[model samples]
Target: MAELIVQARWLVTGVQDRHTPIGIDDGAVLSRDGTIVATGLLDEMKRLAPTATVKTYPDHVMLPGFVNSHHHVGMTPLQLGSPDYALELWFAGRMPARRIDLYLDTLYSAFEMIASGVTTVQHIHGWMPGGYDAIHGAATKVLDAYRSIGMRASYCYAVREQNRLVYEDDETFCAKLPSPLGEELSAYLKAQAMPFSDFLKLFDQLTAENQGQRLTRIQLAPANLHWCSDESLVALHEKATAANVPMHMHLLETAYQKEYARRRTGKTAVRHLHDLGVLSPRMTLGHSVWMTQEDVDIAAQTGTCICHNCSSNFRLRSGIAPLNAFEKKGMTVGMGLDEAGINDDRDMLQELRLVLRAHRVPGMDDDDVPSCPQVLKMATESGAKTTAFGETIGKLEAGRGFDAVLLNWKTATYPFQDPDIPMLDAVMQRAKTNAVDAVFIDGEVVYADGRFTNIDRDAVLNEIADVLAKPRTPDEISRRNLGRAVFPHVKAFYDGYIGDGPVQPFYRQSSSV
Candidate 1:
């Protein structure tokens, strides 16, 4: 690629160092071969690289591209005909949706994410039906789509050894179901089951194959606490450690998961992971909504990151996470749109605004609430730590990849533009998908002016729609109906077996108050 100079009216570089300011008005970035060479005032950049090709955005605000720290197949469960049931039930209900080609399914969400200013995503793959060969093919298709679309992704197929859906063992749960449902579920489980050794082998194969890819990396995901056996979890940790790759897992996403941890291990989920020697700086816990104070302490001590999925928590009735508490403890926190945002789309700017406001408690003091700069860091720098691209894609600096989004200033700050007001704050509060005029990954423009440069958006959308229009298979219909039948028992298992434990407040009052 040719050297380029990108100048904007205002720039938010996402640099959080104590010595530098976060926003630079009338700034420019000079880049070559996907790496930023300099970022400073436009005049200084012009003086430094006089011959570079110049692209001026007089009506735009540029910043580091948003990183989606945790996600699962791009399609929302609700869009797949699964109502907003609790997490467990929603998993079952999503089985009936017509399956599309993995490439299209992955790209469908990629378009939403990129159009909304997200350039990187940690895609946690789950729920593939076939064994090793089928899953390997699916993984290749998903990664190929990301590579073809010019997006950065950390891909991991979630590993589950024992409990597939609920807290109980698969065979035991199947025994409770009546004839055809039980038989169907049993066969499904049998078809999907692969040895733990095979999963590790597949991880090694994928890592070897994608070692030097520009836009994709392979990682490990243990799925969840209830899903993986102790042996499998240990093996996964060892493999990831040996390979020096990061690990991301779902922990305490719901109250039921917390209860399951308590009943099974006689300790909290975080404590269990700590005891198992899996908690480390390389691990990121997704949707830690129900963590106790002790759990937070353990996480901080171990340097484990927490990814907050604000919208999905509300949609699934998973209670609000104490984000303020996590920040107060000096833990590294990242933001994620687990499946979709409040608008049922992957809009990161809106998700950032939601995260900024959701943790504000009843207080007149400003010190306790999240600041605009802090929330922006979570969406960019801190969020990048949770993925494979630890420090490479989050900031606009001398040595980092040129991943960024340019928001149209007219749409983001209209009717109330004041020079004195903080531009980052205004953009965070008012920005929407419509304002995202251009997006860049690896110093190349992938999306600009409402269209993707790498792929034909209309053709891809038409293909997805055509695939979904097909009638559901008989097996899929049976699975959907069976999921409804089993939903009550799943609820009863939690209610009768676990009961209600201590209730923790969503927001904790400051000690001074």
Candidate 2:
């Protein structure tokens, strides 16, 4: 019998097309027990729920909450002492990160994401060094952190069965190094190894644990094309199909990964996945930055989805994803901030602007580049599709979850805004994190006026600072040394991996004028 009504100065229910978004002036949404009952004019919504509690913001604009389709750890790799090395080298570079409490670490990124209006995250968790029970504890802590803060999470333990580092097996790579270093690295890799069945068991256990969860669900991840053996890929895909969940697989993130696929399968990564019958609507490929034209075509034809990690691509030298091409092929693509946004945080507002402006190919054709509605779609409904929530949580419509963000339109447009410019366009261009007035998930105010409702942001941040202030443990120092000693060897493994072949430049349009 619980009910609440939210009214805003402007409301964008969802997108209509590449150019139009279905919005209402003085919009309001009425929800009962976290499920939307109606959306329309403010007066109309009030009439529909006369006795319900109402929260109105006449100077705010409400839109569906953003979904970060691909994410990993709380602290960015850079903060952990990993420079912006290429994706391959960065794996080794990340070894220097100090161990921090999982709950505090999760809150660190959750604070950033929620402040920037991200209500849900695809938390792809993995690469732990321990047995199943230890990893299970870490996973529990992550899920608990999100739940405690009222953030929706679609969690997955990235299934990394082989190729622990580089594109070769761990044993082979360890053998390449000298003693002690080799022995130590081999032991570290072995500590993370468990039977493939253990991965499935973990999934089942996590799934059972989340049977009645309102804010979290377990999903599957194959880690990447090079990390997973073909048999593991097929098994994971089959498990996902049987369980009716989505699988987010990282594929062809770099040229070296693409080269690795060629060496392993004698074909492109996309083709190899296709040959194995793993491409489907239930599969979301993360950072498809190096897919061939044919691969894009196959993905589109098979109804597969893509997550464009715009910031990660830039930070890791992973090259630009063919976002324009994906759109031209009528494919569904979601936006992912990945490690961090352009400014080194999980700012979805900034990520939206980056996605909108980043793909403006030099052209005069209006449809050639991304439009406001297209980018909004990617951030909302399309992004939701790639996660376990799917269509259930996107768009502010009846029968959907009441998850949304209320932005302070007055401040966002403070100074002046032209009437000729569309509202959505102007807001997207001018809005920033400071303008995020409040965030709603499941009809509850999780964040409002720069404050979180369920957790103490400052206290958690200070606790994190206190922990990092203390000296690193002995194990951390040992791992740091191992990471340093193994850097050069790891870098040398990719020598001529992609070959010194001629490369094609961006296609010159037949006519610019």
Clashes of each: 0, 0
List model 1 lDDT by residue over 349-398, tens digit each. Answer: 88998988988898787667888888888889999999989998798998
Candidate 1 regions with alpha-carbon error over 4 angstroms: 15-21, 506-513
Model 2 stretches with alpha carbons more than 4 Å out: 505-513
Give the per-residue lDDT digits (tens) of candidate 2, residues 1-513.
Answer: 889999998999999888899999998999999999999987788788889999999999899999999998887777777888998998898887888889999999999999998998999999899899999999999999999999999999999888888799999999989998999889988888878899999999999999988899999999998778889999999999999999999998888888888889999999999999999999999999888898999999999999999999998998888888899888889988888888889999999888887787776998888998999999999999999999989799999999999999888999999989999999988999999999999889999999999999999989988988889899989889999999999999988777888865333434648
Residue pairs of candidate 2 with colliding backbone atoms:
none
Clashing pairs in model 1? none
RMSD of each: 2.4, 1.8
Residue 202 alpha-carbon offset, candidate 1, angstroms: 1.6
TM-score list, all predictions: 0.96, 0.98
